[model samples]
Every structure is written in structure tokens, then in C-alpha cells.
Target: VGSRCGAAEFACRVNAAVELLDAGAPAAEAARMLADRFDCSQRQARRYVDRAAGGGRVVVAAEETVVFTVKLPAPLAIRVRERARESGGTLSALVTRALTEFLVRGQARPRLW
Candidate 1:
């Protein structure tokens, strides 16, 4: 738990950690990389990695969308799929919308700096 972050930023950080982990980096090493990249504490980095490993989804949204291989526990994956179905949207669309809302809200804030 670092300083409060919007969902898109947190998802981006988590995706980076997942990439490191998928590339065979040890958990501690991945956490260090995440901390360095995001300017966050090691504890915060570790929490992100742990969350992903425990079946959280990692979403990477790009201008030209690319496929990301995320491992989710069966139940959670099923739920997401179901939600997509209920909303009459693709999984990508659902995720994109959610992240977009999060980012938009964050950007809408008045920055002190």
C-alpha cells in the first residue's frame, strides 16, 4: 500500500510486475524492479506482485492494443467473462472502459504542483 493511486496507474504497475515475474525474475527481484520503476516502496511493490500472483488480472492498455497473457484463477476469470457477457461487451472493451474511467477521474483532479 503506497500513496493512493487510481486504478489505471495501479494496474500498469501490476502489469509491469507481472511481466518481470513471467520473465522468470524472482519475486524479490521483481518487487525491486517495480519499486525502482514506479518510485514506490518495496513493500508496495511486493503487494502488487502478490496480488497478481493471487489471481488478480493484469491489464496493459496501449494505443494499438496488444494481447497480454494474464493468469487468473478460474472463478475470477469466469466472473469477468460473465460480466462482459452481461454488459454486451468484449472483455477488452470492459477492461478498457473501467481503466479509462479511472484514469479520467485521476486526470480531472486539480494537481497541487
Candidate 2:
């Protein structure tokens, strides 16, 4: 059901939504287009439009939590850190979100072993 990947993809959709607004399309019309194009719920599309028209990038809230230590290969770690930096989000938030999304998917593929 993930028609869009992450914030980057969502930003692209927001840009398109902005273009629609500039073209004199109603907010509802823009939301309808987003819902149709992204196969997301109309409610979700409307939320997207709200953020787009709200005058800035959509934001994620911070949570209070404990910290853990994990290790990864240098290259992967670097890439993840880079992505977090470029997105203006914390490494913890990004990794936590990704892990949560993956684990919550009941259909996550099983290993052959």
C-alpha cells in the first residue's frame, strides 16, 4: 500500500499540489488528484494539502525515549546519516520510523533459512 516511499517522495507530491493550487485549482481538487494519483485515502491527501498550504515543509514530532547502541557497516551508516542530515530529521527518528514500518507489516518476507 506504499504508493509513495518517504518524505522525499511526499515532497515531490507536495510540489505538484502547489502547482495545482497556483493554477487556480481548489484545495479539494488538488487533494482529489493526490488521492487518485498516489492511491492514498482522501483524508490523507487532504492532510498533505494542508501541510503544503501551511507555508512550510511538513514536520514530524519528537518523542521521549531511551537510547540504544547499534553498529553497522561504515558505508550503510554513512548513507543513513547523510539521508537524515539532508532531510533535516534526527537519525533516531528516521531509523525508528523505518524499523517500525517494516515490523508492522505482517507480510514482511520470511527468510529461506
Candidate 3:
């Protein structure tokens, strides 16, 4: 486990988080900005923001990913529907499974610090 923040670092990060929030930034974005500004990781920035914003987890992991909404190409939509029907699933289920697979494969491996 990592060491808990020293009082000074904790105070500094909290102050930075408050400044960004006061400027009307969303929690996650503000955290990212604060991290960049203060040369800390995004996770540390999030911790700071969480502490300042009532001392709880301010960001959910899944919320960091992309979400897409658009009409699929006509032929692709038809094909997807047919496949879903064959599998006794809805188009949404098929899309979700596909997206999950895509993400799992596409994600970069974690780097050592």
C-alpha cells in the first residue's frame, strides 16, 4: 500500500481541486486539470477532488470510457438484428457484447511507473 498523503500535499491538492471546481469545472475534468497542473497522476487528482467534494469517491471507473450513439449503417443494422434474433438476444445485448470484446482487446496494457 502507498503512504497516506502528508498534510502539506493533501492541503495543496485539496486547494487546487477547490479552485478548479470554483471555476465551474466538472469533477473529473477538474481533477485531470489539477493533476496536470500539479504534476500528479489523475488518480491522485481524483482523490483530492473527492476529499474537497464531501470526502467520497467522485468518479466511477466505467464513467471514464466513451459512449457512442448513432444510427448504424442500414445493412449493418439489419445484419446485427438478424444475428441477435438467431442468438435469442436483443440488438442492444449484441452491441454490448461486441463493445465489451472490442474494449478488452483494444485496451493498452498497464505501464510500470
Listed in order, each prediction's TM-score against the native is 0.50, 0.46, 0.42
Instruction: Report the number of the highest-TM-score candidate.
Output: 1
Which candidate has the highest lDDT of all? 1
What are the clashing pairs of model 1? none
Tens digits of per-residue lDDT for model 3 on 1-113? 24576545666678778777778899999888987887778897887897777642222233333457888799998998999888764465579889889888767666466
Give per-residue CA lDDT, model 2, range 20-102, as digits (tens).
77788899999999989988888888877876786445443345456689989999999999998887666977899888898
- Residue-level lDDT of model 1, residues 34-104, one tens digit each, is 98899989999999898667644655445656676789899988998999888754688887787789999
Model 2 local distance difference test score: 0.77
Ten contiguous residues minimizing lDDT sum, candidate 1: 55-64
Computed on alpha carbons, the lDDT of every model, listed in order, comes to: 0.81, 0.77, 0.73
* Deviation of model 3 at 34, angstroms: 1.4
Query: RMSD in angstroms, all models?
Result: 13.9, 12.8, 16.2
Off by over 4 Å in 2: 2-4, 56-113
lDDT of 3 at 12: 69
Q: What root-mean-square deviation over C-alphas does model 2 reach? A: 12.8
Model 3 pairs whose backbones collide:
none
Cα lDDT of model 3 overall?
0.73
